[model samples]
Structures are given as structure tokens and as C-alpha cells.
Target: MGTKIKISMTAISIIIGFMLAIQFQTVKKPKLRDTRDIWQLREDLLKEQDLQSKLIEEIRSNEDRFDKYETKMKDSKEQALKDTLKELKKDAGQTKVTGSGIVLKIAPFEEAVLLNKRVPEVSPILLNRLVNELNMYGAKQIAIDGERIINTTVIRDINGETKINGRSINSYPFEIKVIAENIKAANKLYNRIQVSPVIDELFVDNLKAIISKPKESIEIPAYDSSIIIQYMEPVK
Candidate 1:
């Protein structure tokens, strides 16, 4: 009776161990890793790879866009050159000059003109006439007391003070540089002028009228002030 009871107990212990081992291997092992957790790991890996590819493609596209922008910028700069030239032409206007040259220097008016006595000061009409006659004789650039004339301008003696191109004139010896067709003709042409006795008598430091062909460059600075050509505007 004692041996039978001992054998039954041993059989029950072995069966219990076998059943627990089978549960760990077949049911508990698969249930421990949930379906949601496995699916999340797969999605994370795919997202990481796709993000890397998108970053690389974005870098390449930005480089191409930058190159195209640089080319457009270059073309814009070249196109701006034409506008610059047109501006230069309008500012300087046009000059008609031929062959060689002559230079006339004007000294200060006599004390009567400067003192504002009963005598009239130098007027705009006289200066304009002189300029017109010089242009007719083919002067290139006309300068009054070192100020260059671009647009049609006036020089006037205001009371005792003098002004040229709407600004005050400072120093003495007004000058005119002519591009002469006939060098000898300048001497003959100037003699014909019916000028004031006081004007004809006035003398510059370098008094003689000079007619010489310019071999070197003659520099005349453009007018410092801007001129609006109201006559040349388009109708509104």
C-alpha cells in the first residue's frame, strides 16, 4: 500500500511540469509581444528611411534653384547698362563741334557795373547772344568762370553780384572753348560783334583770344545741377 501511494505522487508531479513548459512555449511567448508593438517598430524604420531620402532630394533642389537665380541676376545687370547710357545722353544733351578750337576769357566788369550805379549790369540777353554766336561758329563746350554749360542756360549780373546757371558766380575770367572749322575765321568773326565799349575794353589776365587745334583731351565737367526739359515732355 505504501509503494502504490509513492508512485501516484511522482506521476502527478511530472504531468504538472510538462503542462507548464508547454504553456510558456506555445501561448505565453506569442501573447507577450503585442501586435501593436510589432507594427509600431516597422513604421518607425520606414519613416526614418523616407525622411533621409526627402532631406537629400531637398538639398539637390535648392542647389538647382540657387543656380537659376544667379543666372537671372547676371542678365538683369547687363540689361541695366542700356538704361545707364540713355541717362548719360539726356543729361549731357548734344554738342555740334568741328575741327580745331579757340578759347575766350572774360574779365570782371568795370567798377560801375559791379557798384550798382545808374549803369546797368551785364544782362542775360548779351550772354545768350554770345553763346549763340559761338555755337554758330562751332564751339564744343562753353564755360563761364569755369562752369560748363549743358542745357540752355543764362548768365546775369544781379545788381553788383553775378550768377551763372542759376548759381552765384565766384571768380573772374569767364571762358569759352570753341571747336573751330576755320581757325582764322574766329578772329574775323569776333571783330564783327557790336559789343559795349566797356565790354570790349575789359581785359582778362590772359587777354588774347586764342585759336589752336587741341591735340590732347579737353575736359569739361557736366553741370552740377540737374535740368528739366519741360519742352520735351510727352502730352499727358
Candidate 2:
């Protein structure tokens, strides 16, 4: 029993010594602390804050750029739509046109007037033939006696009088305005009309067709009547 008691006391002493050594080591090595001065610490904090501010500014700048880009895209789309509408209106002959073109003056032939014979009225067939020939020669637009000629124009004989677009051709020496694509086209049209057999055909009917030289600018009136649409519906 005495020997067992002595062995238990020795074990307790060894455990106590191990705990004291661990405590002594902990005391000898103090915890590390920041040793930078207050000014240095403040400068570091300011640097971090400046960096954060720059990042925020960059984000804001990017957002602004994106907004501008979106606005530009929207504006471009609207402009394209406007341009398309304008072109459609022009093509439909709803707008007045000005371009390089020529003028044709129609009057009674000199020979017919001197022969003491009443000048014959202009024939619808002859006029229609003339219009078709002009179109074949690249006439973009045409107007006769202050009336715009569109795709729907009708020239016919109504009660012994030649009528165009339902309006009577009341007198002689009327003007027919013809517009071409450009100055070069206008010149080509002039050259072709000068030698066209249509001129001789007009002379056969006791009428003279005097074609003017190509002009740099000619104005054609727009179609004034309301257009009647057929077999067409708006896209949903």
C-alpha cells in the first residue's frame, strides 16, 4: 500500500510540471501587434477609400456609356423608319419632285395653221403612245398641263374631247414636264426624243411636238387626288 501511494504522487508531480512549462512558453512569446504610426494607418485607410471611390466612378462611367449607346441605337432606328417613309411617299407620287429633266410643248403644226384648215384636236391614242415611249426612254416622272401623271392616270376620249385624269385638254401649246433619274439620264432622253419617230407621228396628225433641251432642274407637281387602294391590307 505504501509503494502504490508513492507512485500516484510521482504521476501527479509530472503532470503539474508539464502544465507549468506550457504556461511559461506562452508568457515568453507575446502576441504580435501593429506597430505602424497613426498617420501611416490613416494614409492606408485613405488609399483604400480612394481605390473604392475610383471603382465606383468607373462603374458609373460604364453605365453612362451604355445608356448613350442605347439612346444612339434607338435614334438610328427611328431615323431609318423616317427615311423609309419619306422614300415611300416619294415613290407613290405623293410628294412634289425636282430633278433634271426636259419639257415638251405641243401645239398645232405651222403647216396646218397656214392651210386655212381648223386644227384637229389632240388624239388620246397619240398622247398615250407618246407617254409610253417616254417611259421606255427612262422617264421617271411626267406631268401634262399642270396635272401630275401617276400609275393610275387615264387618258381617253370623252365626248369628242381628249381628257387626261378626267380633266379636259382645253387648249393647244400645253407643256409636258418629264423628269429623269439624273442629268445624264435627262440628256439621254433628250437625244432619244429628238430622233424618235413619235415626233413625225405627231406631225402626221397636224400637231407639233417641240422637245426642249435637258434642264438642270425641273419641278413636277405631286398627285393631288386621294389614292384608292385595292387588294392590299395593312400588316398586323
Candidate 3:
């Protein structure tokens, strides 16, 4: 009986030891692994955030440089063209006149939905094309909601939304102000606004077109040097 008791005690000790080892591995090992994995994840997230911040900064700097460069380039090109025009006017015995003109305020209607979308819609391209026509008609200065139209300025859609000059502009009531030397000529030239079917249809509602003759002195800045001249020594 004593030997049998000793054997039972030894078996119980072995079972307890085996259970303790399993408990340690099941509970402690996973907790250690989880801690390691969480630390790695946090580090990775921080790295991503840092990269994003750097990229944003770089983009902003590049944009600033590009803006200056584009403005300068546009000025140079416009100046060269103006000089050529002046020479032509001299030959033709015509003088370029500067006079008070009209300011046209144009904006898209605020209404986004219709009874049904079965009909077509007005797009930004239509507005852009109209602006191009105005420039072609010799508009002295033109601005859309305070964003100046320059040679390098491009009207683009950003992120499936309306935007101009890198800023998000709503499609509601766009204000286009132009200062020209001749209002009659400008109006007569732009009478074909109906050519842009989208603009004519969409802006037909709540779209107020006003031509104001503001005699404000508009000083059109001169253009910069757009071309470079190179001189070579004669048979050096």
C-alpha cells in the first residue's frame, strides 16, 4: 500500500508540471508576440506619416517656383506679341486705343439637380473656351473669381470636382470680370455664347449676365523679354 501511494504521488507531480509548461506557452508567448507586432506597426505608421509630410512640403515649394516661372514666361510672350502688333499698327496707320469698357459677371447656377438627368450638363470646358475667346478678342485684363487668367494658367478639374488656380471653386455662380478697351467690340464678339451648348443650357437658369461699364483705370503691365539674342563674332 505504501509503494502504491508513492507511485500515485509521482504521477500527480508529472501531470502538474506538464500543465504548467503548456499554460506558460499559451498565455505568455502570445502576449510577447503581440507586443512586438504592435510596436512594429506603430513604427511603420509613423514612417508613413513622415513621408506624407515631406511630400506635401515639396509639392508646395515646387508649386511656388512654377507659379513665378509661369507668370514670367507669360509676360515675356505677351510682350513680344504686343511689340509685333504695334509695328503692324504703325504700318496700317492705326493707333491702339485704350478706353473704358465693360465688366461682365458670369456665374453658374446653384441648382445641381434637375427633374431628371436625362438631359446633358454644362461643363467647365465650356466656360474655359469662352474665356479663351474673350482673350482672343483682346481683353486687357481678365479674372475669374479673382483668379487672373495668364498664359500658363490652365483650367483643370481636380479630384472630380471644380477647381481653378489650385483652389477648389464651386460651380455655383462663377463671376467673370473683364476689362477691355472696347465694350461694344467685346460684346459683339462674345454674342456667340450660345455656341457652347452646355453653358447656354446650364446657365440659362438664375444666371444673370451683366455688362457694367466701370471707368476704372486699368494699367495693363508690360511683358518681359520672351526671347534671347545671341551674337557671334564675324569670322573670328
Candidate 4:
């Protein structure tokens, strides 16, 4: 009976020692609690709001850049098409041009008139030759009697009369305006025509080709007639 009492007392002492150890650990390391005041919490909230606002602004900036890029692409395509159409019209002689060039006045030769020789008509062959020579010497545009000479221009005699673009060239002392690419080009054309044998050839036909000095600005009217398109169609 004494031994049983001694064992119960030892068990009670062990239980007390375990309970004291748990209490000592609880005092050494207590749970942490938030000590921040309401003001500090409000400052943190404002910082978060500012970050969110910055993020929204960045997104809007990116959207604006994308929109501008798309608009520029569309505008560039439209501008390219406009430029191409303008170039086509210029090539077709449908637009009036002004540049440096020279002029030619054709009339009866003075010597032929003095000699009382019958003044022959301006032959189509001589006119064609003169035009070919002028084209070879960098003549960009040519207008004979106010008719613009294009790629489809025909100079043929009909009924013993010379007609240009269905208009009669029966009168003398008419003007033939020629436009060059630039002032230097006009000067070059003038020098070439001065030395060309075509001038003498015109004299032989009793026609005088009086060339003028290169001028700074010479105007050439556009082709006034309709251009008949043959064997060509627009793409679908």
C-alpha cells in the first residue's frame, strides 16, 4: 500500500513539470498583433490606388499608339493611289504643262517670195521628219497649232491639205510650241535645231521654220479630244 502511494505522487510531479514547460514556452514567444494606426493604413491604400491608376494610364497609351498606326497605314495607301492616278494623267497628256521651252514660227520663205516662186504647201513628210528630230533631241512635249502631240498623233495629208487632229493647217505663220524637261534641256534643243538639216529641208519646200530663243516658262495645252482605248479593259 505504501509503494502504490509513492508511484501516484511521482506521476503527479511529472504532470506538474509538463504543464510548467508549456506555460514557459507560451510566455517566451507570444503571437504577433498589427500595431499600425488608421493613418498608416490610409497611406498604404493611397499608394495602391496610385499604382492602379498608373496601370490604367499605361494601357490607354498603348491603345492610342495602335490606333494611330492603323490610321497612318490607311492614309498611306490612299495617298499612293492618288499619286499613281496623277502620274497616269500626266502621261496621257490630259494635263496642261508649263516649263522651259522654245517655239517655232512657220511661214513662206522670204527668198522664195522674192523670187516669185510659187510657195509649196507644208508637206506631211517634212512635218513628220521635223517632229521625229525634235523627239530625238529630248523634246518632252510638242504642240502644233495648239494641238497637243501625243503618242497616237497622226500627220497625214488628206485631199491635198495638211490636217492635224482633224483641224486644217491651211494658214501660214502658225506657231509650234515645244516644251523641254528644263531650262538646260531647252537650250540643248535650241542648239540642236539650229544645226539640224531639217531647217534647210523646210526651206527647200519654200517654208521657213523660224526658231525662237529658249524661254523660262512655256505653256502647252492639254489634249482636248477623247482618247479611244482599244484592246484594253479594266481589271475586275
Name the top TM-score candidate.
4
> Taking the tens digit of each residue's C-alpha lDDT, what string does model 4 give over 13-59?
99999999999999988988878999889866854775676568659
Among all windows of 10 consecutive residues in model 3, the one with the lowest summed lDDT is: 220-229
Clashing pairs in 2: none
Writing each residue's lDDT as its tens digit, candidate 3 over 91-199 gives 2223333444445565433352443323222246755876765654445556666565555455777776555556565654456666554656555435533343434
RMSD to native, candidate 3: 20.1
User: Which 10 consecutive positions of candidate 2 have the poorest summed lDDT?
Assistant: 46-55
Off by over 4 Å in 2: 1-79
Task: List model 1 lDDT by residue over 65-114, tens digit each.
Answer: 56755675687956455555554553364333333445565554455456
Question: Total clashes, candidate 1?
Answer: 0
For model 4, the superposed segments whose C-alpha errors exceed 4 Å read 1-74
Q: Write the per-residue lDDT of candidate 2 for residues 1-236, one digit (tens) a residue.
A: 99999999999999999999999988998788899999889866854775676568659966875676567667797765666677667877899999999999999877788996677778899889889778767788999998888888999999999999899996998999999989998998899788777788887778888889999999999999888889999999
Model 1 ranges off by over 4 Å: 1-100, 108-123, 157-160, 179-216, 231-236
| TM-score: the better of candidates 3 and 4 | 4
lDDT of 2 at 4: 96
Tell me how many clashing residue pairs each candidate has.
0, 0, 4, 0
Q: Compared to the true structure, candidate 4 yields what TM-score? A: 0.66
